[model samples]
Each structure stands twice: as structure tokens, then as C-alpha cells.
Target: MISSFSNNVYKMHQRTQIMRTTTFIKRRFSSAHITLKDSNYITREFEEISIPVPWGHLKGKWYGTRNVRPILGLHGWQDNAGSYDTLAPLLPNHLGFLSMDLPGHGHSSWLPLGISYHSIDYVSLLLRVMDYFQWDKISMICHSMSSINGFVFSALFPEKVDMMVGLDVLKPLARSSEKIVDNYKNCMNNIILHENRIISSEPPSYDWDELVDRLYYGSKKSVEREACKFLLKRAIRPSKDYPQKYYFARDSRLKTTYFYSFSKEVPIEMARYINCPYVFIKALQAPYYESRQHFDKTLDIMKQNPHFEYYEVEGTHHVHLNDPIKVAPIINSFIHKWRPS
Candidate 1:
């Protein structure tokens, strides 16, 4: 039955979210604007696509038309492109939105055996994507873990990215020296363990409802029952050994991804290089993954950029998924101001 306090929390959000969603629907057209193309290629209209990488292909969903350069949408850790299912359609149709399954997530091919997924490699992957599209500049729209990636990428390649929008994160949390050492040790050990499982183990299968329950509790009730379906759509596949059962499609080794964190001073320096039009939305109810002191100091540096905009909204970590109404307006307005056609 998967009953727990977390499930109770999910029930609470569900009760509240229905009202919030209805309000959004009532004003959807006015908020989205009539200027949006009549035949917008978003959400249900999205095209399934794949981008070639060295090892294999990175699969994705392309929202909107192919003619114009699109914003690159990156999701959180362990989440696939479906993380944007609710938010993508709310975006203005002036440009496309390409939500790619980062390596090892969703339908994307996992990295070759033994090559641990590193944070910097995703930056390289973004560059490869740019090269494939032959675009001179990029506009990034990211959430959770990828928010940190966007921050680092914008800071490192200031001139290459035209704009960036991050949801609920600024950068990787600063770790204590001891924490860092322990994490490194644990990361290596986990990597070896997962590698062994990949070769010698068959993943356990769950029924569809059970899959939903796992996602609901797995996200600590941040993703409610209704919202779990979006992520699960891309996260699971039919099991070969079990009739009418499924297994998670993502790479198990991804649970041990080596996050590239820095000392406080480095992120401050990095923040200064981000000169593009940037928007960062903080979920007030979300945990501050790092020291607020570290976040505040780094944020102070970023605020110096003339184009930076920041706001906080009431919701949990997956607010963009669970209650997109609160965030869609900010994103639409930002896009209108910064990326006007």
C-alpha cells in the first residue's frame, strides 16, 4: 500500500494542487498569450528525437518547431526530460524547447562501462549539442541538479551562452573537508558495487501502480501521485522476465554520480563571469542543499550582473512539476523580456 507520512504529505499537496491547477487552467490562455502560435509544437505536439554522442545516442523531446534555435532544457538528477512535461507547454511558442535525457537518464545511452559520470562531462555534452546544432550562442533552462550545471556552464563559458534560467538551485553545495573525503570514498565504492550489479544482476520488476508508488515516495512526496506519471513515463520499461511488470530504465550507476563541488571562494569567482541574462527561482519550501552562508555569498556576486533576476515562491523542490503555475509566469515573462522575437 506504500502508506507513510510521506504519502500523507502527498495527499496534502494533492488536495491543494487541484485548486491551484484549476486557477491556472481558467487563466491559461491569457497567461500564455494569444500571440503563441496557433499550431504550437509543445507537449502533446513534441517530437521524439535523438542526438548522436561518441558512445551512443542521447534521446530527447523537442517542444515547438524546429526552425528556430531553442532553449536547452536540463532536468534534475535521476530525472528524465519528462520532468518538464508540465512546464514545457506553458512556455511561449516563439522558440523551441529541447529537453534532452542527460547521459544515463531516460532513453539516453549510458556511458561506457567504468567511466563514472562526472559533472564536467555534462558541460562537454552541452557543447557537443551546440556543435551539432551549429549555434553560436545558447539559452539554457534548467531545474534542480541541472540548475547547478547551468550556473557553472554560464560562468565558465560566459560568451557562449546567451541566457540562463535556473529553478531551485544556484551551485553545488560546499562540503566540509571531511565530508568531501568521505563522499569521495563512498562514491568510488558505490561505483564498483553498481558496476557489479549491472553485469551480474537483473533489476527487480514492479507493477505499474507500484512504480508510481516508488516515484511518489522516492521523491520524498515532492512529486504527488498525479505528477509521478510524467516522470515514470520516461523512467520505466516493460520487464522481460516478469509478465505485466516493469523495471527502471535509467543506469543504476547514476546513483553514484561524482558531483563537482568547489570551495566557497571558487564559486564566487565563477559567479562573476556569468554576464548573461539569468533568472534563478528558489523554492521556499525546498531544502537549502548547502550552507545558506555559502549560497548568500555566491548570490551576492551574481546579483551584480545587470541582467540577473531572482525570486522565491512557496512550494517544494519539484514545484515546477507539482505546481508549475507559480513558475510558468516568471519563465514566460523572462523569455519575453530577454529573448524577444
Candidate 2:
């Protein structure tokens, strides 16, 4: 009986040792997993940077490690680099993102006093940026008006763009020749008026809440008030005239900037030239500026390409900014598939 009792005690002690060892192993692994996650979080943080341009400089918020070539991010009209703030965090940490504020829009330098901003000018801007970065090929994430610019850039220089992910806009709006002619005179006149006015005038000042309200409404309520802070990052400055008031920092001329529209034929031709992997996310609630037929025609051409992917998300025009959760997963998947090994 004494021998049997001793054996039982020995077996129990061995079982206890095994349990303790298993627990220690699990705890060590858990600690290691947490450390790795924290490291990834730290690496994904953004850094502010400026790229020198012949006109002046372009400001950008770079996310991820500096050594890697980043996907160029372009915001919508009048929006800034902060437009990608929410979405950037949701993207994979292994890849980098460089969200730029187009000239006259954010902290970037405005164009020369007499010059007019044109949609085509942005194509040249893209080229200049690529040249500055010494990137032989680039990937892009463009929103709204900038998405159209990307379309044009990729179409013109197919070899330069490796891939593109567009938010809410596909191509330049198709306009009737008659409407173009009628609007041209007004567009030119407004440019002159805005130039003369901005040369001598300061932007109107507003209280912080008022500025937020304006931004919220200016987007037709598509951008939530909470999201206004992102846009305000590059759009506002402390008022010199009034204490605690802020002024819009973007160039006023942007309001009257020249917009170039193409017909169905132009975009269709451009689509054929786009051979890179392209992902276009269309917001269901966003207005289709061009006629349905024109929009459909352009998509038809793009769909013919095997690499083209399309998604229709339920959101507003500024959906990417207001609700990045809905857009980030789709973009993440696309990026993962095409990202360089």
C-alpha cells in the first residue's frame, strides 16, 4: 500500500509539472505576440515631409517606413493630405502611403499669381512627383477630382503607373461641346476675378465651430462634423485679425479653377491605354455627373481589361473619408494582390 501511494503521488507531481510548463509556454507566446503587434503599430505611424517642386513645394504625410516606395495618395478637390488619415491606419503596415496636398489646396505652395489651375496641369504634377522620387513606376490611391487626374496620368503614361485604386470618381465628366463653349467664357472671367481678388484680400475668418459647420455643409453633409477635423488640418490657420478666429488657408482661386471635361470617346480611348491593375470603388449615393450612358461606356471599356476590378459601396461622395471601414478592406485586398514581393 505504501509503494502504490508513493507512485500515485509521483504521477500527480509529473502531471502538475506538465501543466506548469504548458502555461509558461503560452504566456511567453502571448507576450511575444503583443510585442510584435506594438512594433507594427509604431512602424505604421506617419511622418510629415515636403517635396520640392519647381513652382514651390508639395507637402505630404508619409505613412510607414521611409525606405520603401510609397503608394502616392491624392485627395479630392480642395481637400488635403489629411484626407487619408483614417484610411491609412487601416491599410497593411508592410506597405507605405504618401498622401499629398495638391498645389493651392493644403499646405502646399500655390501656383504663380497669374497662372490658372487646370485638370491637365495635375498630370504634369504627377510626372514631376515621380521624377522627384526617382520612381520608375508608381502606384496611386486617388479620390474624386484627383482620381480623374490619375486616370489621365495613367492613360498618358501607361508604363509609369503600375496600379491605381480610385475612390468615388472614374473619369472626367463628359460635357456637350455647346455647354463647354458656353462655360468657357465664364470660367476664364472667374479666373481673372478670383486672381485679382485674392491678390489683395485675405480669406474670411470664422470661429472653429463655424468653420466645421461650413465644411460639413460644403460637402453637402456627406462629411460628418467629426470628420471635419481631418480637413481642417491643412485648411485652417489662426486669424491674424481676430483672436481665436481661423481663416481658410487654401487659395481662393481653387474655387474658380479651370476644369477640363472630355467626351465619351476620349475616356474610352484612354481606358484602352490603361493596362495596369485598376480598382474603382463607386459610392452608390454619389451623384453621377455625366449621363448614365457616358459613364457606362467608359466602364465597359475598362471592364474589358482582365485586371480591372469594380465595386459599388453604399455611401456618399466623401465615403472614403466619412466611412473608411467600408472602403479599406476592398483596397487592402487589392493592394495585397498586387503588392511587390
Candidate 3:
């Protein structure tokens, strides 16, 4: 009799679980757009468009409008358009901005099924975007890795980008010879694994709280708690099998070294050649890396470049995102002066 009662309880529990999962899925899919409001910023959902890339199609978000002044925005590695959640709203609304999720990040499609991601390829993608828009000139606001891309693009296509504001990491100069070999080896391994369909599966289901906590503690160490919540919208979704469970949409392989490794003479060379009106906001509190001399050498290039401007912002690497006051005015004034007369 007891055995039969226990079996009945187990079945009942399974049914309850199914009902919960169904409810969660309904809720998850129901709200696709979120309106964001803050002291000086108002944000609403933007449309997504797909553009063809060599490896595959890339998805991008259009913020503001085509009629507004044009500014192309780019986010950092592993970060999405959401990276600009705080700053985008602060920008002059009269200007239209296109903030894209580089391949392997955010809503942008990953490289064609078998291919791995490379930092250099993003520069080419930016060019394709310019061609798609038929934009003769673009103003740019880029953070971290994308900042490097912005500088490189500006250098290669000087007329294409009129002015730009780069937040931290203006250039990654002086990589050790050993590091270069290792990175190439790792990228090769990733390419092989990716082609072989050996990429890791999606992250396991987690609670919303746990997801936010991980992002805060891990990648977004400098982000404000309230601001961090905004990123959660893009990072999570209800699981089909569990009612209260949420899962990450990003590829699990994102954390692998195979996908991310520094190569020699990249952004450094890219930065030195930039000739457009550019401002570099260097973080004062954060150390460049294990080595400071190498970072100084890159800074020296910025020093020598006449068109390049540098500012020492008081915060960590991502400080501008959390405290816009430090970076917003710089962006605002630069745009005001550079906007076509």
C-alpha cells in the first residue's frame, strides 16, 4: 500500500513540474520588448536586421533612427549591444546610432556552423555594415575590443568614419612572441573542434538570481546592480523543461581560450595609423595588465598621434558604463563640434 502511495506522489509531482514549465515558457515569450528609463535617458526596443557576412549573416540592432545623425556604435568582446544600455540613452536622440553585436555575441548569428570567431574578422564586418548603409561618413562610440576595431576602421577608411570616442584599451601593444604562437595554436584547435561539432553545449538551467550574480561577480565587476539588471533581459530565458529555471543564450564555448587569445601587433598598429578626430578615455584605476611598460608604449603612440586625444577618466575599465558623467560629456562635446555643418 505504501509503495503504491509513493508511486502516485511521484507521478503527481511530475505533472506539477510540467504545468510550471508551461507557465514559465508562456511568460518568457510574452515580453519581447522592454522600455528603459533613467534620470537622463530613455530606451526602447530597436529592430533587428540581418546582413550577409563572409562566414554567415550578422544580426544588428538599429537604435534612434535613420533620420537622426548617424553614429555607428560597437560593443566589446563577449558583450552585446546591451553593453551600451546605459550610455545609448544618454546620447543625443537627434543622432541615430547602430550598435552591433559582433559575431558570437548577442543576437548576431555565430560564424557559419563550422567556423570559429576571430577578432580581425570584425573589422571586415564593420566595413560590410558601412557598405550596407551606403554611409560615406560615420561617427563612432566604441568600448574595449570594439574600440580597437573603430580605430582600425577609421584608419583604413578615413573618410568613412569622421570622428570617434574610444573607451579604454586604445591599443593592445607589445604581445610576447610566445603568446602569439600559443594563441595561433589555440585558435587552430578551436577551428578544428568547431568544424568537428565539438563545441560545448548550452549552459545548464539556473535561477534568475544566480544568472545575475554570475554576471556581476564575473564579467561585470564594475557594473552597478541596477544597471546590471538591464543586461539580464538579453542573457536569460525560461527553460522548456523547468518552470522557474532560466538558461543563458550565449554559447558556452565563449569562455574557452580557444576562442579568445591575443595576437601580436594588432590594435597597437591599428591605433598608430588612426588619423581621424578620436578621443581615448583611459581608466585611471585599472592596471593595463601584468605588464605596464608595454601598455605605456601603446600610450606613447597615442601621445604622438596629432588627431588622437586622450583623457584620464577616474574609474575602472568599465567605469564609463556605470558612471556616464565621466565619459558622456566628452562624447557630447565631441559630437557637437564634429557634426557636419
Candidates' RMSD to native: 6.8, 15.4, 12.6
Candidate 3: misplaced stretches above 4 Å? 1-46, 52-56, 190-201, 256-269
lDDT of 3 at 34: 19
lDDT of 3 by residue, 154-177 (tens): 767776678888887765445677
Query: Which stretches of model 2 miss by more than 4 angstroms?
Result: 1-44
Candidate 2 global Cα RMSD: 15.4
Q: Candidate 2 at residue 171, lDDT?
A: 93
lDDT of 2 by residue, 6-50 (tens): 233111110011111111101221111111111222123677799
Q: What is the TM-score of each candidate against the true structure?
A: 0.88, 0.86, 0.78
Instruction: For candidate 3, give the lDDT.
Output: 0.62
Clashing pairs in 3: none
* Candidate 2 vs candidate 3, lDDT winner: 2
- On lDDT, the stronger of 1 and 2 is 1
| Candidate 1 per-residue C-alpha lDDT over 1-341 given as tens digits, one digit per residue, 9 for 90 to 100 | 32232223211211121233222312332222111112222324677799898999999989887998999899999999878877777788989999989999989999989899888788888899999989999998999889999998998898898879999989878887788788788889899899998898678899868998898898888886777866877787777898778889899988888887567677788998989999998888899888799999988888999998887877789988876767888788889997887
